[model samples]
Target: KALQFQEAKEKRQKTLAALDTMMKGKDEEAIKKLLEQKQQEEAELQERLGEASQKKQAELMSLREQKEEVMRRIHVVEAILIILCVAFSCSKRRLECNSDKNFDRASSLFTSTN
Candidate 1:
């Protein structure tokens, strides 16, 4: 009976050791899988960042073009206003010249008739 008890105890120790080794192997596999998933997530995040940056750059370029167009329009309007001012000044000078000539001709005719 003593010998049987010793053999059973040895068998139980061996079984426990095997179970512990299997659990350790499973833990290592789980850790490796988790690391791989984290790396994949990082890669995807980088790709998304690149896409967003490109989109923003395009939007900035479009805004710059619109700004340039608005500036050109402002310059055109300024040129038109300057032309209108010059035309108005010239017309006023011509009218004053015509009035002076008429007054001089009327005085000469009155002196000649007297």
Candidate 2:
């Protein structure tokens, strides 16, 4: 039991010594340099993000303009189609009326002769 206790005490002392060296023996200049480098990287990333956002906004505006132009063209085509349909309907009715009058005149002539 005494041997085990001695071994445990030696291990504890060695662990404490290692912890002290790790905490106090480090270089402060190196740590500051690493922190500054990280901050510069973050700034560059933010600048790139801002630029990308602006580009996307410009693209969206262009697409919106294109959509409006297409809508205007569609409205013009719809108006032309409606006008054509009306004209065709009026001509069809005129032809039907003329044919009916001719048919009536022929029947009247046949009855009068008989």
Candidate 3:
């Protein structure tokens, strides 16, 4: 009976050792899965960052083009305004010269009548 008890005790110790090894393997697998998940999340974040960068660059280019277009329009308006000012100045000078000639003719006619 003592030998049987000794054999049973040895078997229990062997079983406990096997269980410990299995638990360690399971722990390693869990750690590996967590690492893979973390890597996947990081890759997704990188992809999103790249997309956002591209979108912002496109928006910046579009805004630059719009600004250039607006500047061109402003330059065109300024040229038109300059041309109109020059035309109006010439017309005013012509009107002043004609008025002076009419006044001289009237003065001569009045002296002859007197």
Candidate 4:
């Protein structure tokens, strides 16, 4: 009877060890699956962020181009206005010089006649 009890105890110990090994394997598998899922989610999130950044960059570029075009048009208008002002000033000075020459000629003629 003593020998039989000893054998039974050994068999029970072996079964318990096998159950422990199976549980450990399942835990490792669960951990691996969780890590894979997390990595996939991270990749998807990064892809979305990249797409959004690209769209924002394109919008910024378009706005910058529009601003440059507007500035160019403004400069053209300013140049035209400056040209007109210069022309007006030159014409006014020419008229004044002509009037002075006419007055001097008239005075000389009158003095000579007297």
Candidate 5:
């Protein structure tokens, strides 16, 4: 009976040790899984940030191009207005000279007729 008790006690110790080892292994596995999940989430967040940065750059470039185009159009309109003003000034001067010349001719004609 003493030998039997010793054998049973040894068997129980071996079973307890095996269960402890298995639980330790499961805990390590759980920790590794959590770590891997966190890493994947971080990588996905980085990717999204990169995409957003690129999109912002593209929008900025487009806006700059549009501003350049608008400035060019404004310059063209200013040039056109300047040209029109100069032409109108020249026309006005020419009309005034022609009127003066006609008045001089009529005065000479009246003097000759008298």
Candidate 6:
């Protein structure tokens, strides 16, 4: 009976030691998996940031093009206004010259009849 008790105690100790080793291995595996997941998440965040930067650049370029187009239209409208003003001034000068000629001719006729 004494020998059987000693053998049972030794078996229990060996089983406990084996269980402790297995628990340690499981803890190590869980830690490695967490590290891998963190790395993957960081990579995804970086990719999203790059895409956002590209979108912002494109928007800036588009706005610049629109501003240039507006400037061109303003220049064209200004040119048209300048041409119209010049034409108006020339027409006014021609009308004044014609009126002066009529007045002179009438005065000559009146003087000859008298």
Clash numbers, per candidate: 0, 0, 0, 0, 0, 0
> Which 10-residue span in candidate 1 carries the lowest summed lDDT?
105-114
Q: Which candidate's lDDT is highest?
A: 5
lDDT of 3 by residue, 1-114 (tens): 999999999999999999999999999999999999999999999999999999999999999999987776665565555445545655767555555454455445444434
| Segments of candidate 2 deviating more than 4 angstroms | 1-26, 94-114
Q: 1 or 6, which is superior by lDDT? A: 1
Model 2: what TM-score?
0.51
- Flag the better candidate by TM-score, 3 or 5: 5
Model 6 per-residue lDDT tens digits across residues 1-114: 999999999999999999999999999999999999999999999999999999999999999999987776665555445445445655767555555454455445444434
lDDT of 5 by residue, 9-95 (tens): 999999999999999999999999999999999999999999999999999999999998777666556555554554565576765
Q: Give the better candidate number (2 or 4) by TM-score.
A: 4
For model 4, how does the per-residue alpha-carbon lDDT over 1-114 read when each residue is reduced to its tens digit?
A: 999999999999999999999999999999999999999999999999999999999999999999987776665555555545545655767655555554555445444434
What is the TM-score (0 to 1) of candidate 4? 0.66
Which has the higher TM-score value, candidate number 2 or candidate number 3? 3
Off by over 4 Å in 4: 86-114
- The 10-residue segment with the lowest total lDDT in model 2: 105-114
Candidate 6 segments exceeding 4 Å error: 1-3, 91-114
The models' CA-based lDDT, in order, is: 0.74, 0.72, 0.75, 0.75, 0.76, 0.73
Better of 5 and 6 by TM-score: 5
Off by over 4 Å in 1: 91-114
Task: Tell me how far the alpha carbon of residue 70 in candidate 5 is from the true structure, in angstroms, after superposition.
Answer: 0.8
User: Judged by lDDT against the true structure, how good is candidate 4?
Assistant: 0.75
Task: Supply candidate 6's per-residue lDDT for 19.
Answer: 92
By TM-score, the candidates rank as 5, 3, 4, 1, 6, 2
TM per candidate comes to 0.65, 0.51, 0.71, 0.66, 0.74, 0.64
TM-score of 1: 0.65
Q: Give the distance in Å from residue 2's predicted Cα in candidate 3 to where it truly belongs.
A: 2.6
